[model samples]
Target: MKANVVVIQALEAQIAELDARLLQQAKLRPEYLLLKTMPGVGEVLATIIMLETGDIDRFAEVGNFASYARCVKSAHYSNGKKKGEGNAKNGNAYLIWAFIEAANFARRFSDDAKRFFEKKKAKTNSVVATKALAHKLARASYHILKEKQPFDAKRCFA
Candidate 1:
């Protein structure tokens, strides 16, 4: 038990050091500041997002960004008939994790996000609702990064 505790402490220290380094690097990027303007996106999340999504302009549209983040459903359709699923694992796994983390935080802190989450949860299960919220956040982040603008709750939650 003592050994386990010691190992956990050492790992935490290493994680803290790495997080500080990431923050230092993220400070040089404008997108980090932009992403921080959104609710639930603090230093860690903003850094993860800015680092994971390099050159937002590479995505021509929000849908493309969302798809890249794995926030959208993946399905193969042929002639309106449902076929096998698409390559759901094609996008960045880190991004999906980050967005889901942000969604969990946003629903707790932001009223707009909470309302949106509740509405979605009413229709679907909690997991789906959280994913929906993550999808919304992903799309919002795309615009925020591409346009170099702060987050607008009205525009996003509306």
Candidate 2:
């Protein structure tokens, strides 16, 4: 127990140093600011999104962005019969983690987000509910990055 605590403290100290350095060297871009306006995103999430998605114009549509971020389900259906699954590992893993983290933060911090999540959870399980919220957030982020605009909860929630 004592050794574990010592290791944990060492890791935390290293993480704090890294965070300080990133803050010093990181250039806050316009898109970074725009994405940060999102409900759950802060410095870390916004930075990861901006860095991973180098060019917002590269994605032609929100669906494409969501797919690339692994926000959407990858099931195959033919003639209204469910086929099989596609390669689920085909997209950016970091974005998936970031969006899920953002969704969790949103659920805790925003009332509207909590309601949306609850509505989804009523129909599905917890994992699906969280993913649905993550998907919604991913779509909103797509628009935010593309338009360089702040997040609009009215348009998003409605």
Candidate 3:
């Protein structure tokens, strides 16, 4: 039993080491670092953003990027009346997941982000609140990287 336990531990360590190597090989580049510098972002989410989005130029505008992240609401309209449910399943799933994680982190570490999240949640569900925060983060990321400027919390919140 002790030998089996040792083997299991060794396997777990190997898996972790491989994961680190894969992340390193992912090649997040510079923009990813800027994303990482955001309040809620970390290496994992940064990598996801880099791998999933590739060049930001692919998006004609930041709004396109935001839509690709699935952060925007989808509404169906027919003759000025609401139609069937619009699809909410577009863009990179990994990016969406990363943004959600970033939002959660921001809620914990950033006072402004937390306030916004709380306010949103007061009126909507927790998921909506998180999505709102994530959308803000995503938009900020696009502008900051485009302008080659560091993230500014005041401007971001404003």
Candidate 4:
């Protein structure tokens, strides 16, 4: 068991190293560093964001990027009744995963994030709360990339 654990740890380290190399190759190390300034976005999430988004110009708008981050509602309703579940299939899986992971991390590390999450949760469920945070992060990322500026917590949360 101990040997297996050591092997697993070694493999995880190797994967992280490779991920770093890939981030460098993509010329996104700077962007990744900028993202790391966020309360919950670390190197891993930053890398995932950069890898998943690639060229910001491809996303015509922040809404498109938010959708790609898996932040859009998956269902639609009309006249106070549920219409069929909307297709939530289109998106970047990596970005979705990264945002979810960051949301989880933020819940643990940032009181502000946790409070926002809880407020959202009181109205909806846990999944919705996480997605809401992901949406905010996606929009923040878009502006940051668009203006070539750093993330501002006040503007981001607002």
Give the winner by TM-score: 2
Best of the two (2, 3) by TM-score? 2
Q: List the residue pairs that clash in candidate 4.
A: none
Against the unseen true structure, what C-alpha lDDT does each candidate score? 0.92, 0.91, 0.85, 0.80
Question: Predicted candidate 3: what Cα RMSD to the true structure?
Answer: 3.3
Candidate 1 lDDT tens digits, 46-133: 8889888988889989999999999998998899999989887899999999999999999999999999999999999999999999
Tens-place lDDT digits, model 2, residues 1-158: 99999999999999989888886787767889889888899888999888887888999999999999999878999999989999888899999999999999999998888999999999998999999999999999999888888999987888
Kindly list the per-residue Cα lDDT of model 4 for residues 1-158, writing each as its tens digit: 99999999999999989977876676565667777877788776787787778888988999888887778876778998879776788777888888778888887888778888999999999988988887777788888777678878778765
Model 3 C-alpha lDDT per residue in residues 20-107, reported as the tens digit of each score? 9978688667787777778998777777776787777888899999999888878888899888766678677887888899999999
Error of 4 at 42 (Å): 1.8
The better candidate by lDDT, 1 or 2, is: 1
Best by lDDT: 1
Which residue pairs show backbone clashes in model 3? none
The deviation in Å at residue 26 for candidate 4 is 2.9
Ranking by lDDT: 1, 2, 3, 4
The segments of candidate 1 whose C-alpha lies over 4 angstroms from its true place after superposition are 1-14, 25-27, 78-80
Clashing pairs in 1: none
User: lDDT score, residue 36, model 3?
Assistant: 78
* Cα error, candidate 2, residue 90 (Å): 0.6
lDDT of 1 at 136: 95
**Model 2 / residue 22 / CA error / Å:** 2.2
**What residue pairs are clashing in model 2?**
none
Give the worst 10-residue stretch by lDDT in candidate 4: 23-32
